[model samples]
Target: MISAALTVEQRQRLVRVARGQEDGDLLIRGASVVQPATREVFEADVVIAEGRIAAFGPGYGAARVVGARGAFLAPGFMDGHVHIESSLLTPAGFARAVLPRGTTGIVAEPHELVNVVGAAGLGWMLDAGRSSGLRVWASAPSCVPASEFEQGGAAVGAADIAEMLALPSVLGLAEMMNYPGVLNADPGVWEVLEAGRRAGGFGAARRMDGHASGVGGRDLHAYAAAGLHSDHEATTPEEARERLRAGLWLMVREGSAARNLAALLPVLREGPRRAMLVSDDVSVDELLELGHLDRLLRMCVSGGLHPADAVALVTCNPAEYWGLHDYGLLAPGYHADCVLLKDLAGFEVLETFVGGQEARAGSSTPPLPGGGVDLGAGWSAATFDVPAHWPVMEVRPDQITTGMGAPGSGDTRLVVADRYGRAGPGQTAHSTCWTSGTGLTGGTLGISVLHDAHNAAFLGGTDADIRAAGAALEQLGGGVVVVAGGEVRASLPLPYAGLMTDADPHAAAAAVGQITAAVRALGCVLPYPVTTLSFLGLTVIPALKLTPRGLLDVGAWQMIGGADHN
Candidate 1:
């Protein structure tokens, strides 16, 4: 039923060979096969005729066959959860970057791209992905603009979810970011959740996954009972264990920024409840260097987890949890998707076979046709604006915090201001920028690209550093910058919409690494960086954050003004 993809003669021949009436189409003669479904290990012959596995065991015959003499055959990996936009690479370009590492399928959430360009942007990615070799599935964005605190390119209502649900590739709603609305039964929230549920329940029925980052215990139970099943926000082992006990399918994630995987490997061997692996917000550079889901497999092994189980995390576990029918195995009648690994420790991919064809051309990656879509157009190749005086605006005398925003005193009451409609669902919150920009005294300064809210708000002794950095951002369109002493100190041009660079992903990664040296040259106390990016706009992550708007109190869901309590 997969259309005229394969010729009739090919199908007949596949059927004949699978039934053993004739010789097989192609054969992987003598290689050790790891079957994740049955947890079986054996040396066998794997044969494929028409896009699906035709036969297995001692012998096979076909017109053309691959010789995988010293390799491990694994089902092409599936990244259970992801946000393709974070990479700053278009779908076509992202695929080109990851395929060589043996990732064949990805469950991507386009909420960020949707925010930047709306449904047309999502539609752009879906159409482009379909024609490519890799298979990409979508999850109807549950939170279009994410939250009210920031501005985006567009907003999607329930009607949009319903429309997206109709697509064959849509995989239910993305992580429901609005827990407050769900708790209060807000109509807008329910409208989108219900539409996605309808689509998920179509045909064989799918599930609406949850994104409750900080919600736990009774609240977690409330969310699970409300029909949201899976979550990737379980950052700690205790958090993940609780979700697992509550029957929520857990997706252990390890993207470029967030790395909560090391603490969760013990759960992999605890039982067979639904546990999946995800690359939630990977960039092209990380995907190119460390790989995708396969990266998790290697990490698991290094962390003392079973290699086969690690592979299972990417294959059978996710397919079963997400209800993907045509993928995740290499048995008779199953789609012919397999990855050949040279070893199990690092689990290096020697070759990847998809639908009876070798996905790679020789040892090198195949060239993308017409190359691929360029994402550099999202914003100009410039930096942002900086003021003359980096407002050290204060409400009290004792609050001079250097890094991220946090209230200095623990007792002063904050003025409940909702001047702008930037508060989340039922919460009243205050925002920065517009007011802080008003009263500015000129001087020299410094800045960091605060990962949580995109650009790092300027922290300065004088306004000149901030002004120069802002000028550089406007000139480069978007990227991280630091201005010091009224001149550009150091800058990294994120030409891909102020988020990523168009340079080779490897070079981009190396460029990002250069910051360590630059920061060492400056002597600061910012501990770690990539992890910092993960906490951006993440009201779910515990503790505090510095947003482009201001410092936010995640638990209270509001921005704490100067002199507010910690």
Candidate 2:
């Protein structure tokens, strides 16, 4: 269950405990706390009781005391924007992966799951993160299917938006990917926004996030004027600067696929107040190897930002931006969430305390149990037909392009099927120009990770290989699968709407490593093949994207090739 915030009577009790009138629950001594408000560090003893900070004073007696060994204590880091589904781990699993790395708070956007299972999926996400030590602040998904270019597994309307807005766990409306809808004043989009505005009447924060990539000038100003608060889609210094000037909190994304940290560092100098660091989407392997916000903090410091400023970006700045009033600080009456760091340069988290209690090292948080949503078998494979000259989806490091690779190289075939029966339980195949640039020489890859829609997408050199891979994914209950020589080579089962697995965090990371190795053996030479493949179905990004219905020219917001194609 979600822990409740401190009540008035509880606050009064904490104050009495601070005065040494009663023994507190916990205490930490011999540590230097990073004071973000003043950019100073001072030695102090901290006292905690009833899940909130009691005081910062000398000789505070408690039922239990832990020696800090002179380590630096800083407020726990917060990921400003992330999709729990993108981690390929259930909410509890993702929490286990990041909590030890000093990430105690997550501003999660469950739009990916909502696109597949509707409002029930969003409820699952909130409940999954409820019992974990990490605090989850979910945002109501503003776009259910993400866009009209593709069909969603389930349709959620303005009423659904209003219902989620009234939820205590939902912070505000998630990233409004429908920027064109806003620009054109679409009535449907306005209905969703209006519901969120009315949710403020129920005492929810009235924040609206943004997603406007490569959009600047008056268009950007208009988007901001429409009441969108922040964006994580900025990829360049220029884009970041423009958004910062436009009054958008720039969430500098450093995800597994989209690595924008190096390029967006300059924005920290331009406007540090409004700049926050976010992973946006990170995989299990990335979390284990590079860590969460702690990794971002180290990169920022190495890139010439002061260590304290880096801490503020992940801590105070994000907490303030999201209006999490009780967190991101160690001062009196704040939540007792703190991270003990071994050093500034490495950002090594020696210990992490959530609500005055230290989480055990390397232990997986309890998984939220659930079954896979059965997308009925109403699909036909014959809809996939390839023409000689079709559009190609070329994959590069951390990005994709449509029809941009070298020609006459025997382009790979793409088949998208509405496995969820969104379009009457049928599958459609359309040929896209693809190159061996991604290095898949002799096999097929199938996955239900088609972004936003969570449909079955298969890529292969031959139709037989594609069919084998597709069947393998169906057998595994919807997840990533590789088939070669008409045999299943590797797979990972994402039972939850084809997005997250209920596996333990460590086991899931290990399985992802095996899948990565298997893909590499088949000549798939991309840095993050799964992540890049997931984005292939995302119609929000620029240029071209392939949806379950057909290939879409995102810029024009229409299908490519012909009106009747696919």
Candidate 3:
């Protein structure tokens, strides 16, 4: 409700009365205030002046007044943790959709996109953040390249962390995802952590966040002990409780497929109280389908969590953890960000205000038009072509060695059988891709990633076809490519770190969708999930997998010879 028609004196009077000061510049009469301070609801006239709360009482009088007879006026919902990139909408689009859902602030990490464009990408975000009409605090991603396992766009080193910490809007280091480095006391990781501490020491206590997925027990203890202040990867109730007991602020998360919020409600209902709600990654479809943090609030109510408790989770808990002082609470010296809701269960929004101005005043919002998001293209398809070097002696024998594995591990051994029959990688009584005397996969597969396994092994009935895909993709550093029947089928150029495309998300997403349809056309079948060939080198999941280097016995978390892993 920003009006030049409303004089500064009026806004002043409203603030005075709303804040219990001498006189308000403007006052909103007959409204219910969801007091975060006491976790209770009360009805009163809210007054505002100069974009701040002036006063709030039944006998409120000001230059202007907004009648709020029936609505839940409370601190705007703040997503304690989120990734705008994961939202699949540009920041502007991201805000446009969520603001109407009563999301007033977000604590976000630009790490996902940062790996692709580096500092330039970050600068674009910082500038756009200023105009979003919402409070956005940047967390300098401690792991821009995520892990040394997979490649990414751009790089954020020690110096970059220091620089970001110095920025006013940057609220300390983003989650120090490199928990291994922290546990190992790596100099590079600490260098950045220490720098943020130094720069953010005075104004606000900037913190280094954490992402220890499987880290538990003493290591978890030592991790919390070392200053990895918060975590969001606890997948189970037990995991959440243990971390909380160990003193790590558990940012109990609820993302795409991982929903840990309901199970962890007891933690919120119980204990010494430092819990917050986070939407680590909400796709654009999900934003439209379900909602933003507002969805979280309603879920809490259904899960038997008190409405006031739900409000506290979204409001005060986050501000306290990240040391975000101003925007989370609705009080005298706080940022005037408030959401008018219909009820505790319905959680419908009637209006939203930031700094005492109505940014959104309806049920729905349009897609955000992100500023400065550059889609760097021009990476060619030739990059995904291959075979600079090959072990040509690859005999037409019982088994073949696919050349994608960990750097020091054995290659993918393709086993050929005397008979034209062998079970697939699974359902073989033993999960081996080989049949004792029969042929391996009836078709061919190309070399790509095996995720944490880091093996670039190709799949397919024929070795040559597999080589074609692997060779083509590897030659280009990294990107998704498909070749079949000895011909290039389709490809997407990820010039950034071989992981992400600099192209706008929409364009990149479209290209990816096309590639996926093409891959499906090739008739490849697996009992897993879909990804842009990015999770290839990962070794965490159990069973057979491949990487840039070779095959892996996931049960062992180690590389195995293509012929056999045992």
Candidate 4:
């Protein structure tokens, strides 16, 4: 719960403790230390004072001492890049779930909330992080609406980026999902990038994260030249190598929908210094069933990576990249954020400490603030009507990107409605399309958790089913719903921003599990149906996407009529 930086008085006390002139506050004794800086493992007793590591070695004395029982002690893990909103929990709720799994810190991008409520949402996230018991640093969302193709609750420009950079907790500009804009030298995009560069004078040089999926050759070089520091969308070793060669930090992502770790392992094996592990978007079910960065650590170790190297991927590597100097190390003068593990091979976390305090599950969550979801007037079951001969979007298993399908060739009908009522004058409130590969044979799926813009989306086999599911979601105040034969089968209410719930992590996760189960029972072939469904409305990623505007041909970068007039 203590700040990572030390005060003047705390520094003096730490010096006294290091000099053996004063007793440390606590001592973790008899442990094999995993030093990621040098990739070394050695035995030491870590001494903590003023919530910082004052010293570590034999003969260190403290008022309280706990035996490690020959455990492996490493610096607390950190997620290089993540969207906490993807977990469908409040910041406190997210901390409760990951703290026990050895994640003491993260570099989160609150773009999802910002997309729903604009810059005000960033303030809410910062407040929530202060009480979450996790050291949460943030990158101001650079792409507020993701792109002009989609309509978000608010639009952020250079001025907003400059103001956000002034906040101490906000490290820099978040993932610039609009790589095309950068390549085309859009004045707005350049202005935003310039804002981040200007913010560098505050302290550490401000960083700009990237999201260049399928970008390569000259385009990739142009993206890196725009001063983007890292990219998390690389799905193959070639892509990872290309980004690294372009002088960009490679963020290997393994989230609920995008599992790129195993595929990008070769790049990590060849050169891990410039690479870090990240969970771009993890679901509540995954967070509860599996661990956070700890799961990534185990995956790395099992995939032929040395334990120390794997630990560094989630620790020192990210710290150095994100300019978190006081973190990712268990050395003197650093914050005493440590994790005790039962073994190196399994990377089983026995205990997690943040600023020298043992992090307990569900101890840090506070009451969440309000104002995320706001549905427009006149929304009802009739809002989901789809015209015949509409453009179709094909969903691929285990990928967030989508491809174009033949018009009216799919059974599942897709509808996107603006929840915030922010559409321009003369613009329609909703758009209708079609989709294939959802594997839904006879039910309707409705969710307000649509990516970026967070519009209400409905996919169903029949008009009645779609209407029923849409109505159920509206009644629940925004969440996911499954309906069949005019009856609501299962639903999870996400009252906050229509993206997350303030409920406990376990309860929220249980609801998500139930929703997933219902979707699977409805004949959905995708492993993570809700997560996949949410991205269908995202206008940024690949070939084709849908929004309240209409069907978007992402490659063509233009909105096309969904109905096939031919």
What ranges in model 4 sit over 4 Å off? 1-4, 202-205, 361-391, 422-428, 562-566
Which residue ranges in model 1 land beyond 4 Å of their true spot? 1-11, 22-25, 201-205, 360-462, 482-503, 524-531, 546-550, 562-566
Task: Please tell me which predicted candidate would have the highest TM-score against the true structure.
Answer: 4
lDDT of each: 0.60, 0.77, 0.58, 0.83
| Candidate 1 structure, TM-score to reference | 0.79
Misplaced by over 4 Å in model 2 are 202-205, 360-385, 400-410, 422-436, 562-566
Clashing pairs in 4: 372-497, 373-497
The residue-by-residue lDDT of candidate 3 on 420-453, one tens digit each, is: 0122332110112321111223333432222221
Q: Candidate 1, after superposition: displacement of residue 238 in Å?
A: 2.7
TM-score of 3: 0.70
Q: RMSD of each candidate?
A: 8.0, 2.9, 10.5, 2.6
What C-alpha lDDT, on a 0 to 100 scale, does residue 113 get in candidate 3? 56
Q: Return the top candidate by lDDT.
A: 4
Residue 273 alpha-carbon offset, candidate 1, angstroms: 2.6
State the lDDT of candidate 4 residue by residue for 1-566, as single tens digits: 32846678889999999998999999999999999888889998989999889988888899999899789999999997899999998888898899988999988899998887788777778877888888888989988788988777778888998898888788888999998899999898889989988999854458889999889999999889888988999988888999988889999999998899999988788855688999989998899898789999888888888888999999989999888888899898888889999998878889999888898544444444443433444443244555665567898878899988777687677777776655344332777777889888878888988888888888765767765666677678789888888898788898787888878889988888887788788888888888988898777798778887788888888887642211
For all candidates, the clash counts are 24, 7, 88, 2
- Scored against the true structure, residue 224 in model 1 reaches a CA lDDT of 85
Among all windows of 10 consecutive residues in model 2, the one with the lowest summed lDDT is 371-380
List pairs with backbone clashes in candidate 2: 378-425, 383-429, 384-429, 391-432, 391-433, 392-433, 439-523
